[model samples]
Target: MSYNKGWRYIAFLSGFVGLLGVTLYPIAISPMIDASEYKKIQKEARKNIRQEDIQPGNMKVWSDPFGRKKPDSE
Candidate 1:
């Protein structure tokens, strides 16, 4: 019973220390962002997309109203 009590105290103290470390982590770290650099990257990505990459019609597998695609040959 004495040995069990010592181990239980150690476990409780370790758990409390772990909880304190997790609570303090975000306060110890900082993140940096550059707005102009991010905007330039976003503009480049937008310009890279072409008009032909998208198909202009919505077709369902169960039914087709416009008959845009042929049936599968399987």
Candidate 2:
């Protein structure tokens, strides 16, 4: 079947190859390649502290300090 010139059969073929790589190559062939660059990012992420990692601020200075109800008369 002939496709319009603008619709790329080459692109479709390349996409099929990529899909085959992801599905078949990983299973039948050798393991997928991994770069060492992500190791640096993993190290940085491990250094960052979570919210509860440090002690919370003093509650006395909080916005709604006492949690008091507003007066009835508007």
Candidate 3:
């Protein structure tokens, strides 16, 4: 049995992409221990909470209407 040249090329490309993702995934999620921006933001948020400036009642619970399945009229 013979396979198309295009199929072989596609299979090779897919394998290459999968391998690339596996190799780079660790590097992607590896956090920068040097950055203090997250710490700063957390500190500011805590300060706001202590001041009661962040109102819970003012926040609206967001919902995705499209997330629920609708019954078919048919």
lDDT of 3 at 6: 85
Better of 1 and 3 by lDDT: 3
TM-score of 2: 0.32
Residue 25 accuracy (lDDT) in model 2: 68
Q: Name the best candidate (by TM-score).
A: 3
Q: List the lowest-lDDT window of 10 residues for candidate 1.
A: 26-35
lDDT of 2: 0.66
- Ranked by lDDT from best down, the candidates are 3, 1, 2
Q: Output the worst ten-in-a-row residue range by lDDT, candidate 3.
A: 26-35
Residue-wise C-alpha lDDT for candidate 3, range 1-74, written one tens digit per residue: 86648878799889999999889765664346444666788898887454344547765455576798777999
Q: Give a tens-digit lDDT track for model 2, residues 1-74.
A: 87735548778888889998889865656433553456777778878765354546633333676789888996
lDDT of each: 0.67, 0.66, 0.70
lDDT of 1: 0.67
User: Which stretch of 10 consecutive residues in model 2 shows the poorest summed lDDT?
Assistant: 53-62
> Each model's number of backbone clashes?
0, 0, 0
